[model samples]
Target chain A: MKMEALVHLVSAIYVVSVLLGTHGPVYGRLVSVNDKPDPKNAAATARWLVSQNSWGVLNTISSELGGAPFGNVVSFSDGEPGKGSGIPYFYLTTLDPTARNALKDHRASLTISEYPIGTCGKVDPENPTCAKITLTGKLKVANGGPKEEIFAKNALFSKHPEMKDWPKDHNFEFFKLDIEDIFLIDWFGGPKPLTVDQYLQAKL
Target chain B: MKMEALVHLVSAIYVVSVLLGTHGPVYGRLVSVNDKPDPKNAAATARWLVSQNSWGVLNTISSELGGAPFGNVVSFSDGEPGKGSGIPYFYLTTLDPTARNALKDHRASLTISEYPIGTCGKVDPENPTCAKITLTGKLKVANGGPKEEIFAKNALFSKHPEMKDWPKDHNFEFFKLDIEDIFLIDWFGGPKPLTVDQYLQAKL
Candidate 1:
């Protein structure tokens, strides 16, 4: 095949491979991208990191541990599939200290890394270019009304199907961060200057 | 080959493939493991998560962000390859908020997930059985003596080779979490009760 045609064929195959790798209901619905975003676009890049990542470390002030900042691994979603709203919602059980801690202090943060998405490749996780976002805010149980609960359920179950099958005895409740600050590091200089307004307004 | 020999051959091939995937000098040197420890061995399990993971979300009280628990993705090492001391050390630069946060407030935690180690298989990241560890303690700059710095260098550079070459202008320094509390979940029920003494004394 000619060079130009060969390049096109390779690109098509790559796209097909990605589609084939993403399987099951949870992986099937969401959009997955490995492209590194331009560091200049702080809001877009920040939202992109949050939307693309499936899980992150949820930080909470542990009253039981003498007020230490305790981070726990968790699966989260901003919305269902490609329709991310730039606000992360989680399904947590009080059995977990994260939920217990939040119940007491409410101060928390969710940190997501771009390295897991295969976009960073060889960059060190600590490297600023690898991209990490910490959404700092108040952690609270979602509104009990059907309107918000339904949205939270769809947002979580659509991305993490296993969560739906989790034992009902766990008393899993929907929790969300009332984002008060955004700290996003996507490039070398420092953390990106992103605000809650800019992040929520960014077009996916 | 006999049937038994063929089975062994296939297993060998699988192991070799894993080694090939984890590259670079640092990754090459570390003894990687994916087997989940028994929930009963809370201390060992906690140490295993720290030893096996090269990076995790380091949480700290962010003074700049109104004292919210700030979590940042960072590369860390507990000790040189196979000799993990159960104390997580980091190579942090003040350009990052985490290091800055630690400078002001020492209260912190390092959270790691077993999902990345490929042992959890199809389990959801947040599933209790998937295993997660949160070492809550004080984040402090390492002692400025040659003895400690050398150990920190060897431990860090051995697992994350790129760190040795990080820009000097960035002023990356060695830091370690003074683990005071251990919260580990390797199976169902809830967080395992593990003390700092138990974790530090656990046999690998």
Candidate 2:
């Protein structure tokens, strides 16, 4: 190989090694630091949090616990890794309270933290600079027809490869939060003034 | 140093390096794998999750959003590292929605995931085997007295050193989740059959 090509090859290997080294053990995909939007950009940052994270706390009003807010750790996908739609989709089973509760009362929220993305560095997870977004809306089955189901499956299975082999009897189906409100805290002031339309329309 | 002592020193360094290599960037503390309780021990597992995790999604019925379940990422501590009290505590300010919501209606839950502890390995975060816990109950201020506040401050600041320096004008105060119910999923069957009493009594 030419000297220039050899240097490029070594640099490529170094980059790949760093990515793998820092990748969340469960989320074995790349979350490029370069792709992260600036904290000042509310809409873009919100979209980035939803798009980059593999799992978040999916909250629903519990039927079992007297309508108390119930939050469960869940894996979600907006789209294939980089091509996210900013609308988080979840694979849930009715056996779990989150799904059953959503079925009865669709009021729910999906909270994603930038802390897990490794970009927060030494910042405390609760620190405003770390960034967190909560998309509050109705959680319901993705009954958008066979086309949407196929898209949901592809989106989930692409990022979480293990989901494709999960027990068939569990009856895991795609559910999504129909975002009505967006609460993002990327900087010190407080929740950013972002709209659902702004979040979905942000270029990720 | 003696040759045997030198060998021991090198081994210790190797172990420390491995531990730091896997520590979450935001949670700059050690969570030993050996300290993890057995999956079959419901109460023990619940306490372990509460103790080991430095942060979780604190859910509240949003007062602003017309009672939608709002989940926000927040840092918490049950006690100092390896000495947890089974009940999680937080340093929150009413300036944020979660604390404000909690003040209006105390019903809340704190959802914690074992994935961030770096113990789940290659298992998908949503998988039951990865372990997740939701402590549901009232979220109220720690008005147990000055003694309790001191304990809360120590529990928080020890794990999250930076929290001690967070803006004092924000009026951050100690808040504890008065766990009325424990929903723990450490293994495949379903939510563990563990009660609040069983969880609090478990030796950590």
Candidate 3:
């Protein structure tokens, strides 16, 4: 094959392999890019990270642990698959300290790493180039009536089907991070100066 | 071939495939288990998590964000390779808020999820069967003798080789979570009742 044709064939095979990997359902959703957005496009890169991940560390102030910062592993969704709104919605129960902590003090942050997305390749998770975002804001329970609840549920259940069957007795309720500050590190130098508005408005 | 013989052959092939998959140096290090320990072994399970994971969300009280719990994606190690002491060590610099926060309050937590280990199978990350651990306590800079620094560096560099090459001008120093509490959920009715003593004493 000609060099140009060979390059096209290789790229096609790579895309096909990634698509095949996404069949796992619970993880491995295809982002808009086969790789990732350029670090300079802060909003797009941040949105892509949130859209592609299914779980992250949700931080809350712990009343039980003498008001210490507590981080918990929780599954989250920005929206149903590719239609991410960039506002992470979570299903949390008061039984867990994270939700309980949030009820008392709304100040929280959700930290998501690109490592688990399988796009960081061999880079260290702490490496600035690997990309990490901490969306700091209020952790508010969804009390915006039935319409909002429906949207949150659809957004969550579409990605995590098992969440729908979590014991009803647990009283799991919808919660969201009302993003106020965005701290994103995608490359060397320092955090990209991104606003909540830019992140929410970014075309993913 | 006999049915038992065929089953054994398949199992061997499965093990070989997992070993082959672990060739990626940065992310895919082989843990002690071909499968995770029984969830009933809380101490053992927690130790396994700390030993196996190289990175997790390190939470700290952010002075900049009005004492909000700030969780950052960071790489860590408990000890050198198979000799994990179950006391998580870190390489941090004051340029990062996490280290500065630790210097002020010393309260922190490190949360690790088993989902990334690839041994969770198809289980949802939030599911109790998939396992998660949070070590809550003081985040102290390693002020011990030169021997302690060497131990911490060896522990970190063995698991994260690239960490050794991180810029010297960054002024990275060793730190460890002086764990006072242990929270683990493997196959849980709730958080496992493992104590720090049990976690530190458990044999990996």
The lowest-lDDT stretch of 10 consecutive residues in candidate 2 chain A is A20-29
| Fnat of each candidate | 0.68, 0.75, 0.70
RMSD of each: 4.8, 6.0, 4.5
Q: Pick the candidate with the highest DockQ.
A: 3
lDDT of 1 by residue, A98-157 (tens): 899999999999999877665665667777788888898999999869999999999999
What is the fnat of model 3 with respect to the true interface contacts?
Answer: 0.70
User: Using lDDT as the measure, which candidate wins?
Assistant: 3
lDDT of 1 at B118: 53
Which runs of model 2 end up more than 4 angstroms from their true locations?
A1-29, B1-29
CAPRI grade of model 3? acceptable
Q: Which residue pairs show backbone clashes in model 3?
A: none
Tell me the spans in candidate 1 whose CA falls farther than 4 Å from its real position. Answer: A1-34, B1-34
TM-score per prediction, in order, is 0.87, 0.89, 0.90
Per-residue lDDT of B75-175 in model 3, one digit per residue for the tens?
Answer: 99988777889999999999888999999999999999998876775668899998999999999999898999999999999889998799999899999
Cα shift from native, residue B36, model 3 (Å)? 1.4
Residue pairs in candidate 1 whose N, alpha carbon or C atoms collide under 3 angstroms: none
Clashing residue pair totals per candidate (backbone < 3 A): 0, 0, 0
Per-residue lDDT of model 2, residues A1-204, tens digit only:
454554445445435544544333444245556767999999999888887789999999998998899999999999987788988888999988899999999999999999777677567898888889999999999999999998899889988989899889999999988999998999988889998888888886
Better of 1 and 2 by TM-score: 2
The TM-score measured for candidate 2 stands at 0.89
